[model samples]
Target: MTALSEYERLEAIGLWRADPQAQRRDVILSLGDASLVISDAKAGSALAHWSLPAMIRCNPGERPAIYAPSDEPGETVELDDEVMIAAIEKVHTIIESHRPHPGRLRSFLIGGVVLCVGAVALFWLPGALVDHAARITPQAKRVEIGRKLLTELSKMAGQPCTSPSGDQALAALSKRLPGHDTIVVLPEALMGARLLPGKLAVIGRNAIEGPDTPEVVAGYLIATEDAAAGQSPLKRMLGDLGPSAALRLLTTGNLPDSGITTYAEQLLRQEPTPPPTDGLLRAFRSAGVSSTPFAYALDPTGETVLGLIEADPFKGQPSPRPVLADAQWVALQDICTGR
Candidate 1:
């Protein structure tokens, strides 16, 4: 149920009733991750969440179509927004298309033994399904999922640091980098830099504060991107959450909040593995930044990361230009300090 890009976060006005006998009330209907959210128009408080898969159009092909969740017969909502109705119908059709057809059952059963053998070779059925889901998942859905993870992680990591000057400096720094990701500096709890989906990266306070040159932080960002080349952060998250989470996302276009919270808790304690040396050096070369600073940052003695030092792309020479201006660097360093 990966929703269409145009319909992401779509909303419309509607009338809702808690039950058959209840009076209809004005509500705002919003397209949630995999459900329709009914909220009080005046108070803006969420009243109910109706699963899209279970949604039933009671008066199909009629104006101000009446709808209800199959699970809750008495509750109903009335919506006349043609765009919203079309979006929901499209999602429902996609879900239905994925379901097994009774007519194909015989053919499916005929290949059951072969499928079982292939599944045994793969060692897990969900792995294939998860991979397929990850491949087909659109950018919009990835951003939505990443935003949800960040919301959960913020509870443990603390709110992201922001200030007028610092935010502008961060924006400039992103433009200087290769990926131009939305870089967030957290007050505390993150170690180095971690890249999330949707071209977002989060770094610990030290990345900006400890480095004398912005190249150091830029190197960390580049390294994180290269690290994700092997396995995307989104796919890694789904795999960690287990098969059911992936299945839910494919069928319902949403991951269970309980699973997300649990995964966020685990992510807080886990350390990021360093990117490969060759790949990291290549990334540095591509970004026109020297790796010496980052290598020394990892090991001050430079004994362990000697290759990064000697193979520095800009060794014995200045970078093509400064990674950041003197003033911008100062602003970024004090981002958490609110200076």
Candidate 2:
């Protein structure tokens, strides 16, 4: 309070009593910005700081005024300094003039708090809840969700090709591939490959049946994994499912069947775009596979996919290991034939 600056350094002598039964002692009373400071006269050590506004004159309209803190009436101060008394009264007047109405301020603060809460519920809760749910979901649960999504996707993509030998061959390929544990071959409605939740990858039948070398199909699988960049597929699915379904899944541990069907339809409509060239090359290097075959498969002339061809990790060098055995490759090619 700028008005208080005039009396800020003002001091007075007063008699102070700690409580009703204590002896009155000489004290130095000093004016503070918003308080009255009391100190021991002999030691000059602080005794108390009383709020200027809460100072009450116990006996008003008399000489040698007796005053006490509003909260503690037993503790009192006896002062005869007219200048200090007048300064304190002036400060009280200034404070009262600047004070807002208690009722109005309380109402305003309550309303602001309520609006903040409502905003959080409307805008922030859904995305945060979805993120939390995605982080905590177990691997087993993710696999279950992926299977359920595959069931819906199968309606459009066609059921996965399953022959005794083909299934075993696919399992071997899955083991050979890094990042994902399962590789599902569909007869149609898939171009290159798609990585799903729970380290599952879905590929078209042509990837195996049409290619001469297993490296081509392996490259496609690696490309899909690179495209995903280690993101949780369940999080992507939940994003498409929206907040309501995400909340339901969080509470019930299951997504809505209708939501899953809708997401599958959306997934089928979207084409899988290739990951960045640099990242694809890195994935190829890490997998110890050549990118030449996959590059050629994307563009037979090798014109459009020249970067991948030129940066092939196995260029002018033999691969560290074969992606699959000759027998496994042959069996995988016959997967759709059910032979």
lDDT of 1 at 208: 89
Model 2 residue 45 distance off true place after TM-score fit, in angstroms: 62
Against the true structure, what is each candidate's TM-score?
0.63, 0.65
- Model 2 residue 51 CA deviation (Å) reads 33
Location of the lowest summed lDDT over 10 successive residues in candidate 1: 178-187
lDDT of each: 0.84, 0.85
Best by the lDDT measure: 2
181-225 per-residue lDDT for model 1 (tens digits): 688887778878876666677788878898788888887888877
- Cα RMSD for candidate 2? 11.3
Backbone clashes in model 2: 0
Which residue pairs clash in candidate 2?
none
Q: Highest TM-score, which number?
A: 2
TM-score of 2: 0.65
